[model samples]
Target: MTNTHLPKPEARRQLLLQLLKQHKQLSIHEMTRQMGCSEATVRRDLDLLEQTGEIFRTAGGARYDDPLRGISFHEKEQLFWKEKEAIAAKAASLVQQGDIIGLTGGTTTFLIARALKDRHEITVVTNAVNIAMELAESKKIQVVLTGGVMSNETFELSGPLAEAKLDGLHINKMFIGIDGIHHQNGISTHSELEARMTSIMMSRADRAIAVFDGSKANKSSIFHISPISSLEAIVCNTPLPAELQEACARDNVTLHIADGEPDAL
Candidate 1:
């Protein structure tokens, strides 16, 4: 490909990261061929990404390094993008003016925050650094960021410090993102810290809602957050299994199915 045909620097770098994420590890030759760029350009992109700690430089290539067992936030953002957006929109529709809402870290909740950006007279309580930053510029929404150690993979603040902050606040509603939702295990996540923190947040909220895509249904992760009975409702892209549906009904938990369409920005 010629120079004029090349993507801009930032776009090219983002594409390179996506490529690396999809292929895991790729040599210089492979990346150059895949990216349709010269070897020198691919090398420079790899060097910059490595410097930013986005990838690990190998002998003649780079590999995506995801230290956390769960999928990284960037990777998760790409998976079920439309479904997540739809779930977020459905969750946001439940918000009311002057209501204090809690948001846990995940692509779905992040999109929920975006969906609420233009609304007025609402407050957002969150443990996600990126969500906090996303709402910082909103003139109408009040943001409360909990203090704790931020995870590189999830951008979520957890530990004692974050839990302590939640003690004083009362949330009208909370939209939690979890790795799995099962009939028996209820809801769970990969990180124990996240599970603990999310549980605490749920306790403080009057209504706790789980927001996820279709893939999370009938799945259980390593760390358990709470049982299915604890949730007020669940919003997802597809209908849940019969067992889960029966569980939700027995527990009086409401279920909402999103159309998986893009929310109007």
Candidate 2:
């Protein structure tokens, strides 16, 4: 039972689901080992998981769900720390002094908040309570947290209050994260409130930038915040797939694939 494959689709699916929930991000080798299946079988199962929103495949592994979007900070801390920090550091360089930026919720944005610590005199509005708290101590930067119901699972402020507050403010740029970046639906996430907040923020901004790790590509979600055609740039730590690159080119969106290095900034 330890190293065996559950051949039945229902059995395989159940086992796969259990593993996905238990392991925040399970590597291919790990899946291959525990599931007692061929690499191809594991890949096929992962694809089913991806399609069903039970998991998402990354470069070396697969995360629990579509975005790993609703994870606790403790869970998120386990993945993409260096890469997310570097992504945030690179994202910060895009901010010109005195720019009003709309920020969204997620691990990458948390890193963005930390990177913002050194900057001053920017009006940063966000639905992320963590980001607001992080930037609030800075006397130089004005942090406005939207009034909304807090999501304990994700540490974000979302729902009507958040969207209403964002609808009134027009900013120079907005930085957001995603659960999925599909060619069909563009940027999406699991939470409707969060997704609505994302759309409202982008609508009120001059330019929209979707920030996520390279892991989010080749995925889709139910709630779409904005079409990929609506964004200004995509900032990530890895190169997007050629299809994605070409899609952005067709849409005239700038693709900034940072190599996890701050010197590039």
Best by lDDT: 1
Name the TM-score of candidate 2.
0.81
Cα lDDT, model 1, residue 48:
76
lDDT of 2: 0.80
Candidate 1, residues 79-161: lDDT per residue as tens digits? 67888888888888888899999999999999999999999999999999999999999999999999999999899999889
Q: Report clash pairs, candidate 1.
A: none
- In Å, residue 246's CA in model 1 sits off its true spot by 0.6
TM-score quality measure for candidate 1: 0.73
- For all predictions, the C-alpha RMSD in Å is 11.6, 4.5
Q: How many clashes in candidate 1?
A: 0
